[model samples]
Target: MAVDAARDGVRSRAPARERLRAGGRISRAARYLFFGAVLGYFCIPMAAVLIYSFATRWTANVLPDGYTLDWWQATVSNPRIQSAFSTSMALATLTAFIDIAVVVPAAYWSRVRNARIRHVIEVAAAVPFALPYVVIAFGLMQFSGVVAPQFQGTFVLLVAGHAAIAFPFVYWAVDGAMAAAGIERLSETAEACGASPMQIVRLVVIPNISSGLVTGGLLSFAASFGEFAMAQIIGRGLDTVPLWSAEMIRSYSDTAGSYNRLAVVTLLTFAVLFVLSAVVVYWNRGQTVRLLPGAGASDEGGRR
Candidate 1:
């Protein structure tokens, strides 16, 4: 009877261990499957674009019969494309700078003032993101004639439109960083040391939140660079890369050259944004390492 009882206990323990092992294996399998699906979803479209960019002909065939750089060359040589590309780069940089300048101060002020004010400002910052693009565009157009007639159809308005859309991204990025860094405590410390508001901002606040500032600025720049709807309506017939690409697609010819050219433009935009994103990622890693405990000691040891 004792032997039978012992046997039963052993059997129960064996099944429990096996069940845990099976559950772990299933969990890992599910995680891999989920990630694999996500990876494929993004990579598949990018792979298609890359392949099509070099193809001389794709229609009615599994792959291009020939490959050529003629489309890329043509795109590079086109004066209109050159102008639009430069315009986008310049506008994106300017818009990003403006966003940084505006968002950082506003976020800091709201935090320093009161909770109600901060909430109100946060809602206001999100207005552009929440409102439909059509509504914003129409409102801008409606007021363009009356508010600032001379400003309409100029680069100023284009920058303004881009800035409006990009502000929320900048605001959230910097605001979150401030909160995470415990800006209020840091400010109190600075005040205890007899630092002025300006001194605290320049010496303490900016340095601590530098990572967030870079991230926010770059994100805002990318947003402005790729904005289509606002540029189309608020730009008042501006010749942006997106608008030009749309026109090319609309007036497609029987030949595959047009499609190839469009693909090249698309890839160019992707490459630029990809580089910026990579920079941000690398910078963030460095920031994280620097902020980690005993990071300086590790660095000194490595140097030795």
Candidate 2:
């Protein structure tokens, strides 16, 4: 390997050090600009939501005329807003629990069974993802109308719909992480060493994908939280936050105060999720060893 490296080094047009030094400046600049553009695009919506939530006045101007906490106070004080927020939270928490159980085992089993089958499973997971929310919600509602009338208007219907949308996120996210990092080998090796399949999965697979899992769950939660179509179509009167906000906008244009209050609620939801996502990212980075392929795969029980 050393000799091959030396031969390859000598055959090159320029010394690697000089070539790297000469071209790195242009490459780095391109990378910076690419990332800066992406970041700016993400910041725009968030900035709008935050600024408008606090903005005391609005007009034809591009920016808010002023800012205040009246929106926050009104949002918090409104019992309707509180009810909607609570509903969203409950729905999200339920989705997270359902996702964690289903996604990991399915991903691991798909990997264990066949990679081509894995592709099929992934497609199923993502099929709903590609569809517009309203299209799927209407389909679900129509299907439910014929197949199961009992679920027409209830929290159960909302959760199932939310899970359908959120499932794609959790499945793909953790599945991608596991596939990229040889997580199956970790589990396979564990089971070979007298570890039960359940133990191997619980201790090894879960730890490695914990961050990805949580991140996926968070994405699912956020997706469910802001969901408008599912709730409108089939959630009945159990208004999730987004449905409530949309109704407020439609019903009360004369009531800008209500709009402001909805904006404040949205801002708060964003803040909480943003903080949780940051913490998950930070925690994973700090525990960096497990991220490497097979980095923490071995154990006292030999290769477990």
Candidate 3:
């Protein structure tokens, strides 16, 4: 009986080891291809931007006309560019701040419980994600013009518009993080240790899910920063970066220098968002490492 049992165990071990080795080999090959494609795609446009930012001329040619610092100076010295940047910074800050206040606690409440409420909130959150900006903007115009006439065509309305759109971003990202975090034990442990609900969230939960919050916040910032239609339609003279950039482009296409400067601005916008996104991805990776058994376990654990 001992011999037979030992043989059976050895047989099981052999297949398990074989499967593990095979998977590792397969993953290495797939990783190379997947990472290569991703790196290539992301780097290409930014490379073009960097090239163009320095290029005196950015046209469809075999190669760029070498490089020059004049475009750099043109972009740097423009007062309009400076104003747009300041507006973008201020607007994104307010949007992220407001969204955080609303979304984080709501996500925590919706999660850390029976999941039915979370499911409902998740569905509601999807509404903004799916709705067109045009529709949202129109709705805002309607609401602000009537019930909240004091908000119409003001910073209050603009911030509110940004916050509404940003809510779903923070809510979904943080909610997904909380779901992955093995919520019950953490909440129970915190409660047992004489922690109030608010304290449990402020210190324990938020730190653990910081990555998601940061990611969601950055994405919200980017969305608000790049918002044009809503700002243009709502904030005609208020002039956030995207709106101002659009206005500049619309008004001036005759001058090559102006276009080059605009391209530089575009590059700057893309770079900022790209860097922010990269930071979020890195942070999310860290969160995944902390929570999951291993890198591949997350996809499998969901089914479990």
Candidate 4:
């Protein structure tokens, strides 16, 4: 009787233990489910875009049927598409170079010569981010008439607008690089070695912060490439890639292959941006190893 009573008591306690374990497992499963749901929510759209790019038919179907490259071929063969692409590339390239030319010197000067003015300039850079594109577009339109009355509706205005909007990105990138590489201290050391200011910048500063320059350049290029509002407003007749894409999408009927061209163009842009991002990642990884001679070795030693 005593043995049976002890066995019954153990059996009674087992449910409580199992219940606690089950509750923990349920909580963990719920967490995973929630995160998975969020991931799927964001990914479905991009995946749909990718699928639609190659899809011959998608209507009334859960998945696209009959993949084809015809849309990609058509989009590429269009002369207007080519011109718009060229305009976007040219504008982006110019903006990137301009950003490097201006931000590099300006950031270095702010760090080495005057720290107080950095705040003011940084705030100025944020103007594009703080204000809406419509507001900036209106302001630019108004000022262009006063500054260069004949320059309105020109490609120069478009480039200038893109550069202005992209300034913050370039400035922030270069500034971050300067801070990370301790450029001010490096500059001082170079000065102590009898190097001129320009020499210090050209040699020590530029080499150390090359990653930042590339990042800023890529970001500027991407921003300029995709910018629509300013292009539509300031550019007027200038049909950059984004404007062209927008026009095409707007005019597209509910036909089977109409969206395919737009999707292909979008995918192309995405691929370019993705490649640039990958390059930046690769550079950053290599940079950590190359920044100082034996720097990696010393880090390993310190960790040990």
The top-ranked prediction according to lDDT is: 4
Model 1 has how many clashing residue pairs? 0
TM-score of each: 0.80, 0.73, 0.75, 0.82
The count of residue-pair clashes in candidate 4 stands at 0
Q: Residues 16-113, candidate 1, lDDT per residue (tens digit)?
A: 34632233444556656766999999999988888888888888787788888888899899999999889888889999999888878778887776
189-292 in candidate 2: lDDT tens per residue? Answer: 88788898789887888888876787678767777877788888888778778787787777776345666776777778778768766765675665433322
List candidate 4 segments past 4 Å from native: 1-23, 285-304
Instruction: Estimate, for each residue in 147-229, the C-alpha lDDT of model 4 and write its tens digit.
Output: 88788888998898888888777776677688889998999999999999889988999999887888788878888888888
**Runs in model 3 lying further than 4 Å from the true structure:** 1-49, 57-67, 113-120, 286-304
Candidate achieving higher lDDT, 2 or 4: 4
Model 2 clashing residue pairs (backbone): none
Q: Write the per-residue lDDT of candidate 3 for residues 56-139, one digit (tens) a residue.
A: 655668667677888878778878778878877998899998998887777777666555776676566565667888888888
The alpha-carbon lDDT assigned to residue 92 of candidate 4 equals 95
Per-residue lDDT value at 57 in model 2:
72
TM-score of 4: 0.82
Best-to-worst lDDT order: 4, 1, 2, 3
Q: C-alpha displacement of 8 in model 3, angstroms?
A: 39
Per-model lDDT: 0.77, 0.72, 0.72, 0.79
